[model samples]
Target: MPSTEAPTTHDLQATARRVRRDIIRMTAAAQSGHPAGSLSCTDLLVAVYFGGILRHDPANPFWPERDRFVFSKGHATPAYYAVLAEAGYFPTDELLTFRTLGSRLQGHTVMGNPPGVEMSAGALGMGLSFSLGLALAARMDRAPHRVYCMLSDGDCNEGQTWEAAMASAHHRVDNLTAIVDYNHIQNDGFSDYTRYSGDGDRDRVGGWVLDSGYTVKGAHPGAGRGGPQGAGRLMVRAKGLDSSLRSE
Candidate 1:
C-alpha cells in the first residue's frame, strides 16, 4: 500500500529545485535540449510526483492501477527524468546517461525504457489524446485513477490539440487534467509576439480551453508567470473538460 503520509511541501520544493539544477546540467552534458521548457515545468512535475496526486510504484512501472502522466512536450526529458529519479523510478545515477547512444534516456520520453514514464512523447499535441483514451478505459473498468497531461504553449497551435480538446470534452473525461506550460517562447522566438502579437488579450490558450467547455482557472496573473521561470508553479486547474465523467 502507498504511504498515507505525504512528503512535506518543503521537501517537494527542494526536489523541484534539484530537478531544475539537474535539467541545466544534464542538458549541458547532452550538448542539446530544451532547457527553457524543462525548467518551466519542474515545479508541476514535482507537485505531481510528490504531492500524492499520482498513483505509481517506481518498482513497478507497468502497474495497471497506477495513475498516468503524459509528457506531451517531450523535449522536457531532463525535468521528467529528475522527477522519476526522485520518485525512485530508477537510480539517480542513470541520469548521467542521458542522450548518449544506447542510453534509455533519449532526447524525448519513451515508455518501457525507464519506469514511471507512462507514454512516449515529444511529438506535441498527442499526449492529451492518449491520456483521454487511458482515462476512458479506466472509467470503463470502474477504476478511480486519473490522467494528467503536460503541454507546451508553442505546441497549442497544432490543430490536433483543438481536436483532442473537443473529443476529451465530448466524452467527459473529468479524471483527466491538462496543464499548459505557457512559457510564451518557442524555438525561434516569443510565441505570443510571433503568433498573435503582444496585445492586451486574455490567454488565447485559456480561451481555447474555455471554448471547449472546460472550466478555466489561471495559476497567476501576467505574462510568463505560469511557465518555466515560474518554476514549480501551478498555473491553472480546469474541471469539467470531460463533462461525461462529472466529478460532482
Candidate 2:
C-alpha cells in the first residue's frame, strides 16, 4: 500500500534522484529509448508515488479502488517503469531488460504486461480521451478513485487532445485531471516555432491550449501538493527536459 502519510522533502528528493538514475540506466541498457522525457517527468512520478499523492497498493495493482495514472507521454516509459518499480509494483532488476524482445517493459507502455500500468499508449493524442473514458467509467460505477493523465506539450497540439479536453469539460468529468509536461520540445523538434517569453526561461507556446478553453495551472511536483484539483483543468509544469532527442 502507498504511504498513508506524506513523505518528507528529503525523502522525496532522494527518491527522485534514484528514479532519475534508474531512468538513465534503463535507457542506457536498452540502447534506444526516450530518456529525456522520462527524466523530465521523474519528479512528478516521485511526488505521486512516494509523496502519497496517488493511492495505490503495489501488491494489488489491480485493486478496483486504486487511483489511475495514465502516462499519456507514452515514450517516457523509462520513467514510468522506474517509478512503478521503485513503488514495488515489480522488481527493480527487471528495469534493465527494458525494450528487450520479450520484456514486459516495452519501448512504450502496454497494459497487463506490468502490474501498475493503467493504459497502453504510444500515439500522442489518445491518452486524454482514454483517461476520460476511465474517469467516466468510474463515475458510472460510482467508484471514488480519481484518474490522472500525464501528457506532453506535443500531445496538446493533437486535435484529439483538444476534443477530449472539451469533452471532459462538457461532461463535467471532475474526477479526471490532466498534467502536461511542458518541456517545449517534441519529436519533430521544438513544440512551437515561437520565440521565448519575456522571462527567457519560458516559451510563449501552446496558445491553442488557452484557445481550447482549459485553464492551465502551473505546478511544482516536488511541492507534493498532489497536482491541481478538479477536472477539465490542465496542469502545466516546467519540470521536463528541454530537449526531446536522447543523445547517444
Candidate 3:
C-alpha cells in the first residue's frame, strides 16, 4: 500500500544501481558471498520490486494479496537484501549486519530473518517448484497476484528445475513467470565448460519450457526465439534486459 503509481524508468534504474552498490558492500562485509551473479541481477530485482508488478508492503510482508518472489539463486542474497531495504521492508542500517553472527542477513536467504523474503532458499533448483506451488494455490483461490521466480542458468542443470518447469506448465500457472540470470558462469568456472559443454543447451532449457506450453523468457542480450502470446522476451545485460516486462 506504499503507492500505486508506477516508478519511473530512470528512478528504477537508479534504485537498481544503488542496490548493486549495496550488494558489493554487503558481500565484502560477509567476505564469502557471490558478487558476479548478484551484480548481474540487480536490475531485474529492481524492475520487479519497484515496477508495481509486485504487491509488497515492507511494513506488511505477509500480505496475502501481495505478489510473491522467489530467489532460486539464493547466493545472491546480498542483492535481494538491498532491494528489500530500499523498498522500506527494513531499516537500511541493518544492511551493515549482513553475514554477521546473530544477524538476520545470512549468506543465503532465509524466511525467518526479515520482511520481503518469501522463501527459505539456499539449495538450488527448489525455488521454481516452490513458486509453481504458490501460483497454483493462487489459481485455486482465484487470487489476482502473480509469482516471479529468479533462477540462475547453472542451476537449471538440476533435474528439479525441469520437473518444476513441467509442473508449472502442466498446471497452467500463467501467473508464474520465471527469469533466468544467464551469466554464462557458475561457481567452479564458466557454465559452458562446467555444465552445458558449450553446446548451447543453456538455451535449450528455456526451449523445453516453451515446448511444454509454458511461456518462456530469456535475459540473453540477443533474442533468438519468441515466447507464447502474452509472454515476455528480454535480452539481458549486466545493467538490465533489452525488453522486459520488468524493465524500467
Candidate 4:
C-alpha cells in the first residue's frame, strides 16, 4: 500500500547532526556501544523517522493502529534512540542513560523497553522474521498499518534474511517493506568481499525471490542486469520491485 499521508522532508543532514550528537553522547556515556555502525546508519534513521514515510506519532507511540518501525540493525541503538527521542517518543536527555541498569534504551533495542520499539533485536538477520510477523498479523486482522524494517549490509549475507524475504514474497504480505543500509561494511570485513560472491552471483538464488512471486527490484537488477552501482543496498517490498543500490 502507498503512503496514506503525503511524505515530508527536512534538512536531513541537520536532523542527522542532532541524532548523531545523541548517538555520540549515548555511546560515550555507556562506553560500551557500537559507534561506527551507529554513526554510519544514523543518516538513514534520521531520514526515516524525521523525513521519510514513517507514519508515527511520538506522543502516542502505541496508537493501536500505527505504522510499525523495526531496527533490524540492532547494534545501531544509539542512532535509533536518537531518532526516537527526536521524534518525541522519549526525552532526549534520557539518552545519556543508555545501557545502564534498568534503562529503557539498551545497546540493542528490546521490545517493551522503549516506547516505540517493535522488537528485541541484537542478533543478525532475525529482525526480518520479526517484522514479517508483524506485517502478516496486520494482514490477517486487515489492519491499515504498514511495517518498515531497516537492515544492515551484513544482514544481507544471512540465510535467515533471504529466507524471510522469500517467505514474505510467498505470503503476499503487501504491507511489508525492507530497507537496507549498505555502508559496505559489516563486522570483520567489507560485505562485498565477505558476504556475496561479488559480481552479482547472488542474482541466481534471488530467483527464488521472484519465484516466490516478488517483482524483484534490486540495486543489482539480477542476472546480468546489474546497475551502475554493484549490489549492496536492496529494498524489497510486497507489491513490486523498486531498487536504489550502491557500489561495492
Structure candidate 3, residue pairs in collision? 219-236
The lDDT-based order of candidates, best leading, equals 2, 3, 1, 4
- State model 4's lDDT: 0.65
RMSD of 4: 7.9
Q: Please identify which of the two predictions, 1 or 3, would achieve the higher TM-score against the true structure.
A: 3
Q: How close is candidate 4 to the true structure, as a TM-score?
A: 0.75
RMSD of each: 9.4, 6.2, 6.0, 7.9
lDDT of 3 by residue, 60-125 (tens): 888888888888888888888888899998898999799899999988899847877888888888
Clashes of 4: 0
Runs with alpha carbons beyond 4 Å of true place in candidate 1: 193-248
Return the lDDT, model 4, position 193: 30
The residue ranges of model 3 lying beyond 4 angstroms of the native Cα positions read 193-248
Candidate 4's residue-wise lDDT over 8-84, tens digit each?
33355567678878877888889889887787766556656655457777778778788888888888888888888
CA-lDDT, candidates in order: 0.67, 0.71, 0.69, 0.65
lDDT of 4 at 102: 81
Worst-scoring 10-residue span by lDDT in model 1:
210-219
Q: Which 10 successive residues of model 2 have the least lDDT summed?
A: 208-217
Q: Which candidate leads in lDDT? A: 2
Tell me the spans in candidate 4 whose CA falls farther than 4 Å from its real position: 1-10, 193-248
TM-score winner among the candidates? 2
